[model samples]
Target: MWTIYLGLTGLAAANPQVVGLGNYTGALEDPRFLTSLWLTVLYVGGSAIIGQAGLGFTLAGILRTRTGPVRRLVEGVVLLSWIPPSTVVGFLWFALLDRDEGTLNALLHTPGFAWLLDHPLLSIIIFDVWRGTAFSMMLYAAALENVPPAHLETARLADAGVLQQPRDVVFPASAATS
Candidate 1:
């Protein structure tokens, strides 16, 4: 672990010289680095914090009450997102977002609009939301499963609405998993 951590601080594989912290200082001074860092924060906040977590919790709540084909179909779609290899997922996104022959352009009838180049940050954030939603969904589902029946009963006795019960009981209990 120590070796791996130390290795990341040194030179690139192409460069023979080991410049400890030199690359870090250079990156800190670069304007492009600052832009990239801001974009990274946006990507994480938009995709993971808001998009995935919110969608996952909503799916868990909806699917838990559902039965038969509806539940199966929803689960299958969520599972499918996680089943593909990361490389394959990346290629699929690239193909879908391609400017000339991309699916989006074809559907919209607006070809020659380079989405990847024109909106790289947004593209990556959206891609990440799509890719990561399954994990959060599964996590929330498992957490919801472990919620005690007493919580629901108490909420019911109090005449709490459906949404309020989850906020007061289910969500508080499942907060750790999320």
Candidate 2:
């Protein structure tokens, strides 16, 4: 391990080519790179910022409210997704989303669906959601635990409905921190 590290360090020190802001300027000027960067921003915004946050919050809410067999099973599956290494998750999604006979297309009964080629941004967004949502779920679960049960009890006394209680009690409690 040290040999590989020293070798890479030696290679880097040997070729002390400093381009200053040239590469940054060039990348900014390139249409393809700019477009790719913009698309990446969109992908992160759509998936990590929105999709994962939403799903994680929703799943956390479900785990908090619902009970019994199906909830246990779904919680198990979601927690399983969280435990796997991200590389493993990536490879799994890669194999599942393969263009030719991917799991998704196969399930949809569509053949030769070029998912990555035709919808590269959406594919990346979907994968980001898959690999990142669990983190948000775990975060929310912990946050939800800190919420005061007295708030919920008060909401119940006020005849708040299922969703209404969370809206009135939980969200407001967590809003400042969030």
Candidate 3:
């Protein structure tokens, strides 16, 4: 309601007048706004599809075969990464990526390298992947669990390689859940 009123009546102005579609037209005419929109789409699509889903599924597949403390530790760490509030994570990332006195710079021995400024999109995509992978991992883990051991045993008996077993048996069996 507020946005509609502001757009139609130029309510933001002291001497308000009916501007009709003028505000929207002005925004659409701006190249920077269009570029930002494009970047936003790219960021969202890339982070969800390529980064989170890909890495999450891959991790799930790899971890599915393992048992004991290693699996628990990895899952715990990933969950910890996901469970924190975004603001806290953002602050931690900022501190880690800051050009001056940053952990990354100190470790890399490349001081004064502005990671966030130089690679904002990549940084955020990676951050989003780290933040969001837990959901996909948990989902895929559950789905992978439903894949019958008998099918995997049959694949093994047929001389299927390690990767082939998951690619052929596990993936198809879990496709519905995915």
For all predictions, the C-alpha RMSD in Å is: 4.3, 6.3, 4.3
TM-scores for all predictions: 0.75, 0.69, 0.74
As for candidate 3, its clashing pairs are none
Q: Name model 1 segments beyond 4 Å from true.
A: 1-33, 156-163, 175-178
How accurate locally, in lDDT, is each candidate?
0.85, 0.80, 0.90
Please provide, for model 3 over 1-178, each residue's C-alpha lDDT reduced to its tens digit, 9 standing for 90 to 100: 9878887887557888998998889889999989999999999888999878888888898898899999999999999988889999999999999999899999999999999999999899989999999999998888989998899999999999978987899889888556
lDDT of 2 at 84: 82
Candidate 2 on 1-178: residue-level lDDT in tens? 7644543342356674554555567768999999999888898789977899988988887787677998788877877877888789878887787888699889988878888889878988887787677789888887887778788888899899988977788888887567
Off by over 4 Å in 2: 1-34, 153-168, 175-178
The numbered model that scores best in TM-score is: 1
Candidate 3 has what TM-score? Answer: 0.74
Q: Total clashing residue pairs per candidate?
A: 0, 0, 0
* Candidate with more favorable, higher TM-score: 2 or 3: 3
Q: With candidate 3 superimposed using the best TM-score fit, by how many Å does residue 142's alpha carbon deviate from the native?
A: 0.7
After TM-score superposition, the amount by which residue 49's alpha carbon in candidate 3 deviates from its true location, in angstroms, is 1.2
Candidate 1 per-residue lDDT over residues 130-160, each given as its tens digit: 8888899998888889788787899999999
Model 3 local distance difference test score:
0.90
Pairs in clash, predicted candidate 1:
none
Task: State, as a TM-score between 0 and 1, how close model 2 is to the true structure.
Answer: 0.69
